[model samples]
Target: MTVSPLVWTLTVALILGMLVYDFVFHARKPHVPTMRESAIWSAAYVGIALVFGLVVLALWGGDFAGQYYAGYITEKALSVDNLFVFLIILATFRVPRQYQEEVLLFGIAFSLIARTGLIFVGAGLINQFAWVFYIFAVILLATAGSTLKEALKGDEEEEGDSRFIKLIRRIFHTSDEYDGNKLFTHLNGRRVMTPMLLVMIAIGGTDLLFALDSIPAIFGLTQEVYLVFTAVAFSLLGLKQLYFLIDGLLDRLIYLSYGLSAILGFIAVKLFLHALHENNLPFINGGEHVTVFEITTSLSLSVIIGILVVTVLASLYSPRGRAMSVVSATEMLSERYLQLPADATDSQRDAISRKLARQLQRMPRISDSLKDELISDRRHYMELLHEVHGEHLDYLSARQSSDDTSSAESAELERRKTAFSDIVNPAAESVGSAEESVGSTAPEGSSEGRPQHH
Candidate 1:
């Protein structure tokens, strides 16, 4: 069935409208979404996708609808897997929690544009050559094997130091600290790219690679360009909300890669069978089409759904999964707490410190080596905090003694002093107590009375 240009235009317009709405209404003001907010918005986006799938059913019949659902599911699962990398990139850049929404929304919009182009290109390739499926099969199979290997090796950390990022760093003057959510900021009397821009670039580059895998995978299910484009777009629609909703539990889904590998491998086999049915290579089968078993869309959907259900259940119940989750959470919490910006509010710092303390209490459940590492990290962070606190005190004392100190300077000093005494000092003391409780001694010269120098 051919879709009219009118229909395509309307569809594209609608998707773009939604993207604009998300940007203007949700991500315009940077704020950390609460659990309730994340869950509600995630569900709303998913519901919108489902309704569009139903529209496909009404307009193009059950067959096209099945294809759409299957393609959407596969792409959505792949998107979830990609979120792990997004988490790493943001954490590596130490993006402020409030500003993460902007980064994610930009990545999603960029991915949609890139994938739409790839979808049309893929369609053209299929129309011109019968051998493209073979190439797609090879790609999916290779990706599947790579994913499986990674899954077996346990969680490996990504430093977001991809060659592209390194190249960008070399080519552009970049700022270490983010100036709010701006991609570019003035530092030392000159404008420079901020980590905000670098992280977005990392995500955009990742999206391109993801499109390479996803376009072919979806093409394996259905060759209809309209369905392909719509499926990919809808899958990405609510991804930012989904990321926030699942980030805390991402490490808990230990078997997700295994399931994705199985799905990709299954699609690869299906693609190979389809390719055989349309064989045109002269070396084998005499350049004639070969008839073979082809997997139906219904069966493909069922298999994908079944694999996901089993994977999620197994991961949630697995003891090892729980342990890994705790370890990852601890590391992330520590990093976030230690990397809090100089202008971060006292409440924000207190919140992170409380979370870190809670994670510390669960330290006994993790491996001894990991626990030791976390303990050392906490101790080092405490010493740094003490040092910063002392510096703030000195600044406050100097300001108090200066006769020219303005009201604004006095007010700022009071705020800093309150933050240090109320949040910073208590946080450092709590970490010290946690370390002692875990049978680790605090480092020498880390006591409150000790004078520390930068």
Candidate 2:
């Protein structure tokens, strides 16, 4: 467990190199990775981790190597659990498949940094205080209970409305939609955060909760900070590829939560046993060393690996799992269809359309009749959009024409009234003048003229 400065430097460099390679090659271009691509990358990363374990075995003794393997297995299992939350976040945000890699990468980076700090603090506290193991055990036991409850209910979607997300919404001016992969975009003249940003924040917040269990669990396996850190780093590497490679498999792994609960429960008992063995508390066995059975690292590692295998096998063969597969596939496609943005580019739309069509064709329960009907509906939707667009244009044109006709008619009516007013006013003035002149001439001799006539 004695890690030299040289070893530390080399290890950090390797991890950084792997991250950079992932970024430059796999994540540089945004695309839905093909299954083959995901499989190859996932296998390669796992292979690298196995090789690293072998190197640790050669450098250190068998005990340290065993501890490393156990820690890695435990962390890897926990990482799978973390994936459930990741899927929820992605689906809740309706992240486009292409940008999902970016989101996961950001999440992984944030988790790594945050875990490193937690590891340091945890190591320091464990060195100073032996009771931390008891606390860790209690926490892991509680987490196991929580995990078991969630598994029984199958309620990963509850993470979609996490308080972290609500807090962010309250604090920031956020867009109701994504702006490609950008975390921030200009809406009008103000800056607004996108769903991408919100997802990353959610991932970070969840990772913090996960670390509360993971760090202590690893500490129980080995107090060597180097082993704990390396195990976590290796376990988390290439998780993005694993996410894609096993995307469909996740739903089928219905027993994973149960397996995880068992693992956590077992580890918690181990931690408590170790705490008893090294008891320093006044109330516990009169502060004396208790003769509790200590579980070896090899046993712990074997149990974890065995549980994971059994869980996977049981899930794949279970009737419920089989039923869920079809339902999950349908739900995934439905989400994709619903999430297609109205303002998405044509290429983006076509990509999603083709993806949905392929998924529909691959579904065994979906009859050919249904497939054809779904395809027909897709086409009909496009046709309806075009028809609606044309109708909207026609309606606008008719409205403009009616407005112009009304305006012209009003102008003609006003012009006719003006002409009539001009002619009538001139006649009225001349008649008034003629009446005034006749009255003026007759007024002087009106009585005398009238009498002679009589």
Best model per TM-score:
1
Give the Å shift of residue 337 in candidate 1.
Answer: 4.8
**Residue range 321-393, candidate 1, lDDT tens digits:** 6665665665566555555566767577657556654654554555545435434465664555555445445
For candidate 2, the 10 contiguous residues with the lowest summed lDDT are 445-454
For candidate 1, the 10 contiguous residues with the lowest summed lDDT are 437-446
RMSD of each: 6.7, 24.3
Model 1 residue 235 lDDT score? 96
Clash totals in order: 0, 0
TM-score per model over all chains: 0.80, 0.75
Tens digit of per-residue lDDT, candidate 2, span 1-454: 6899999999999998998888888677888898899999999989998888899999998899899889988999899888988998887787888999998988888888889999999999989999989999999999999999987875655565688789888988999888888989989889999988888888888888888889988888899999999999998898999999888778778899999999999999999999999889999889887998999988998998999999988888765565456445544544554454556564654454445444333344434443343333433322222222222233233434464557766565445334433432232222234343233221211222111110
Compute the lDDT of residue 144 as modeled in candidate 2. 93
